[model samples]
Target: LSDRLSRRVGMIVPGLAGMAVMAAVLGAAGWLPDGAALVTLVAAWVLLAIPDGLHRSSASALVVEQSPAPSERGRFMGALGACGALASVLAPVTYGFTAQAAGIGCTFLLSAVSLVLALGCVSRVREASSPATPE
Candidate 1:
């Protein structure tokens, strides 16, 4: 479902999901009442998961689409997998220190900022590679 959605909308799904994550993260930053905090946390978690799932599926499909040849596709996918593995390993340690030093709220804010930056980079890459359309 998400794969088809991604194909139709390109980066918009992930981009919007990233924005939702930012909003939810900000909401989870304790502006709400105690009762609402739990709800906000849950909502934020769900929003974060949406982007994660969408990104993984879309990125995998993009890898397959962009690979030059069948022979190189395996290597491309393997490299992508390696990058994901490295991120999984490093993210926890990085987040722990960041949260410890900057507080959890700041950590969430930083994560949102990173998401925005990533979205911008993806947009630029897509624009550069996309074919020009006739007026």
Candidate 2:
């Protein structure tokens, strides 16, 4: 409901929504013919740019949220950072392979599906942790 949560939702949505658009563009531009390596290289670069901005916002959220709870804040932030690191290592390789084998449409579709599922999950988490009275 707030801009903060909206931004997080945007983070996941755009990656799926935008990546689908991008995959279509790459297909139209005939970049797919240029081979998986070249297409993946360029796609990776572009997607990386938008999502990193999203990640930065999430990082800011973590800092802001943790400020009052000085105790355990470091552990909380550290675990969050570590989870991101794990995703970084895994996502590219998985996406690259998916794109290479199934074509860009499937790749985009996969991302979209992932985003939808994540949105649902995050919404639930937010609902659970949120105060009974909305702030």
**TM-scores for all predictions:** 0.74, 0.51
Q: Estimate, for each residue in 1-135, the C-alpha lDDT of model 2 and write its tens digit.
A: 224365345454454445445544444444445577576658755865674466466544534453445575667777778987998999889889987998665665566566556545544433213312212
Output the TM-score of candidate 2. Answer: 0.51
Q: Provide the overall lDDT of each model, using Cα atoms, as 2-decimal numbers.
A: 0.64, 0.55
What's each prediction's clash count? 0, 0
Give the residue spans of candidate 1 off by over 4 A.
Answer: 1-27, 127-135
Candidates' RMSD to native: 5.6, 6.5
**What lDDT does model 1 reach?**
0.64
> Where in model 2 is the C-alpha error above 4 Å?
1-69, 127-135
Per-residue alpha-carbon lDDT of candidate 1 for residues 35-99, written as tens digits (9 for 90 to 100): 78777777777666666766666666666656776678789999989988998999789878987
User: Candidate 2 at 71: error in angstroms?
Assistant: 1.4
Find the candidate with the highest lDDT and give its number: 1
